[model samples]
Target chain A: MDLVLLLQRIFDALFNSAIYSSLALALVIIFRSTGLLNFAQGEMATFTAYIAFVLLAGPQPRLTGGGLAGLIPGVPFSIPLAIFGAVLCGMAAGAMTERALIRPLGGASDVALVNITIGLLLATNSLMAQWWGTGPRFFPAIFPTGAGQHFTILGARLRYSTVGVWVILLSALILLVLLLRHTKTGLAFRAVSISPSNAELVGVRVGPTLMYGWAMASGFGALAACLSANSVLLEPNMMLRVLVYAFAAATLGGLDSPKGALLGGLIIGLSQTLIPAYVPFIGFELSVLPALVAMVVILLIRPAGLFGTQRIERI
Target chain B: MSAQAPRRFTPVSVAGLIVLAGLLVAIPFLTTTTSLRQATQIVVSVLAVLGVNIATGYGGMISLGHGVFVGVGAFATGYYVGDLQLPWLLAIALGAITAGLAGALVGVPALRIRGIHLALVTLGLAIVFRPLSKRFPSITGGVSGRSIDARFDAPGWWPSDGRMASSVYRYVFCVLIVVLVLWATWNLVNSRFGRSMRALRDNHMAAAIYGIDLVAARVTTFAISAGIAGLCGALQVLLVPFVSQDKYPAQESLVIYASAVIGGLGTIWGSVLGVLARTVLGKAGSALAGYDGLGPLGEFFDLLDESAFVFGVGLIILTFLFPRGLAGLGRKNQVPK
Candidate 1:
């Protein structure tokens, strides 16, 4: 039991925990408003990350490839500006997806919803591959990540990027709380999430409210992708593995609970880092197995999760 | 209850059958051995799509991880044939059965997890499979994948001994197996057990009231569906003697599911139609992609070359325009809840 190594691992795990927490929060928002899980969330986020990449890299056809690259502005933007632009683009896309694709279905079957999302996943993934080659692209870190750019405490070095990510995550989370609690739109959103029919009866536009929810969720997802892109490397399939971890976190915290998503993210992220370190066979690549197994076990024993409301079905 | 009327083949259907049969017969002569093998591989993929149809459309379980069973089937068949020194036919059968047993294992979890959650779990399984299989290098050939030592070849009774002959032999075998399985599945879905399976899918409580063993029906439906997919995988090895993890990506599973949906679910012919649609669309996309005169539009055309993109867009369009799928286009829009 090397205490220093363990502490170091925990510090490393916190960065991922923040990533998973934000992504899980994104999942929770959508699931809370609509019963359908957005399987395309990761891909959508990845697309935004690409948008940021294009923004930062400017109109270099050689770098960004053909197609939409021709549409990007000629001047390169700073990293924060590029990320900001990407998040905005992501929010708009999310809202449009909800309005165009999902709303038209008008409360379709589970299978139909699954088909639509999966369709989006496949299309967006290939589209990214087409625009930006399947090869990994370098994304600049939002925070300084040079050697010695870390804090030492208790004989363990904590990277500045980890603290910087948490700061961003926590501030965004606080903003989310404020918006949800203080704003009228947030109240309407809460009402819609609780009961769409009732909210409609009370004069709230359930459709637009749900669209806002989707936008907000997508914004969170975009942020997660942008923040983690430096660490994970930007690619079409970058978020596929991260999506699993976030889903596990969401499920663990209770699929429909926001606070649970954050907590679940913390726990799943730590386990992801620690389990692989301790378990000889799991290694780094197969660490996803534990998160998956945990998800199955949680689904089996506790369908509602720690914080989610228990669903009552009438026969 | 009064006896139901037997379904009669319409003139249109008879014409369709004739055209399909003619195309199947002409394929070997029209193409080289390589193209013939590719055509056979496309035909074999129908079984995988059909597996999804059974589990999702007929059995009422949305299994997005049928590709896992297919991978298991291929790997297991490779092991049984190459390592165990068994005959190809016996190994193929055992391979399918092995996949069926694995499906039964997944089906156990599915008993409690229904609808979208089941879909989530299956998708997770699909993602996990490649990494999981990599751990077993001996059986799965680790990361890069292993090649089988033995080849499935034609016997000397009535055929010329050549590479083309062996290719033709494998193609015929695959087509025969696919048709046989399709016929068997059609019968099974219309049988008493099949009724129970559908009954459970429609309403498990009502099904249980009608004396259907919910557990047995659900598990068996998944098992049979997975077995069919496994058979597809076994035939894949027969066509190309390579078993690799790269072949079974999460996207592959989604594509298979998309095929099932696009072809239409709950109908045997829908499975075949789905695969046909995929083949036709892929060829058309690639041909269009190759044309340089389209200018800026060529970029969009290039996207067509990627089957995942085509299927993804197709799935969305079909979901909106023809919820019942291509097979259900002219039929009444009576999509079951």
Candidate 2:
């Protein structure tokens, strides 16, 4: 029985780990493509989740009701439409930020861009809060609402939705890796990432690639936000904690390396679960502390992050 | 020595300043209740901005945590003015000195790190200051926010509630600090030490090549800048005689930077100009007189949401248009051709 319980504990840990990784991956995507340590990504995600709530406000908020994500006889289509609307808005928001703030100061160094993003994060969140008001609103589960809907394989009960999250992340990761590996646009992105000046010489459409990166990032961000909002209702400060995790994951995985970002997310997720469970007095409040400290220390030692070996400028 | 450094005080300049100073000093006597309160707040921020000028404007180190130090000064002044009941000059001296030490403690880390990382650390201190002030409510008066009408109560010869006399006394306080700080900064900047800071900024390696002690200059600059920020914080604390963390939050740092840039980077007079713009344009300025956020125009145009947007855009525009800042005031002071 103890042996079965240990295995169960490990499986449970992995499931919990993957959830945080989803959000972390979104942060990593933006950081890798654009050299912006975007503090706004989480807030952007929160804003979209709030929008999703607004979209389903009139109809049934619960999935069983007549609203979006509801299982009501006639209103099965609202859920997917709400999700689509959120994704589209996220993409538009990302692009608008680029044009309004980043594009003008295109030639400026990364530090300036980073500070600009910080300013954006503060300003946008405040503006959104003013519009939405300070309240947590319900966001429907994309899949089934039942926690008991689990698959028993290898004598382990696997949550259908939890398993679905992993499958979605893995598929997306593979697609991203392949696109970067195989396509011309991906190659242009790689070139720009390595050296913008050289990429300009190579005649790659760098501006569009940056926009592409932002779009993909926001799309993934929307998905992550929607899913997390299922567990925790949407609030303006919803993404603040997740942003810190993603930053830690990105930093650990190698800030500039995409593969590193994936691994970084997994490692952070595991440690977050395992450390607190295994160690006495290592509670929830302190779980993120380790990750944050580690990232800062790693950056200090390796400046480029764990897997990042490139000589990125200090500023 | 180029006739004691250009202070925007050539023959024409002197006449302009004399008239301006005359007006500022004369306002209280001429104005009624509401105007006196407004003038007092303006003068308070002016002194506060002068401290910002020393570090960011002259030293080229961004210290957003200047507000914490300002609060320290205010609290110290509050203790001296309201509690200990010391005289104004003595209270100012003790408050400035006390705040300067606090500035040095914060300045030490700045000596190690540069730019945003350092800015964040100082900003973090500002974050800490709010909670810490409240935590030690005995000293800070916590959320209640310690207020003192003692400073407003004029001394023996000033005559009680005499608006003109009260305004003159407050104006004298601002003018004395501004003149003294500006004069000292001018002397410091024109010297070889000032050249070394500029050199380091232009090219750290090249500056080192000239045999300048890079660390010493950097640390000294931070120390000096911080001390000045502390001084300003102290003055600001006393200027209103209301000591609280709400008075000096992290946002004040941004205003200081904006004012410094708008006034003219490294220009003494520019710092004052930057303060003037901030006092007049932003809500923090408006807050001095008990107004919140921007006025109607701010809301209608969404300027309320885009507060830093204005500063960020303004900095870019100013940098492109005139890298010189308000230093134009010093042009004629170049000693008769």
Model 1, B1-337: lDDT tens digits are 1111126776766888899989998998888888999999999999999999999989889988999999999999999998998999999999999999999999988999899989999998999999999999999999999999889988887375666888888888888899899889888888998888888888899999999999899999999999999999998988888899999999999999999999988878889999999999999999999999999888779999998999999999999988888877766646645
Listed models, DockQ each:
0.84, 0.15
Clashing pairs in 1: none
Question: Which tens-of-lDDT digit does each residue in A1-315 have in candidate 1?
Answer: 999999999999999999999999998999999898999999999999998888888767686443365575654788999899899999999999999999999989898999999999999999999878899999999999999999999999999999999998899889988999999999999999999999999999999999999999999999999999999999999999899899999999999999999999999999999999999999998999999989998999998999999988888
**Model number 1 iRMSD:** 0.6
- Please tell me how candidate 2 rates in CAPRI terms: incorrect
**Error in Å for residue A179 of model 2:** 3.7
| Per-model TM against the reference | 0.97, 0.71
Native contacts retained by candidate 2: 0.02
> Candidate 1: which stretches are off by over 4 Å?
A65-74, B1-6
TM-score of chain B of each: 0.97, 0.77
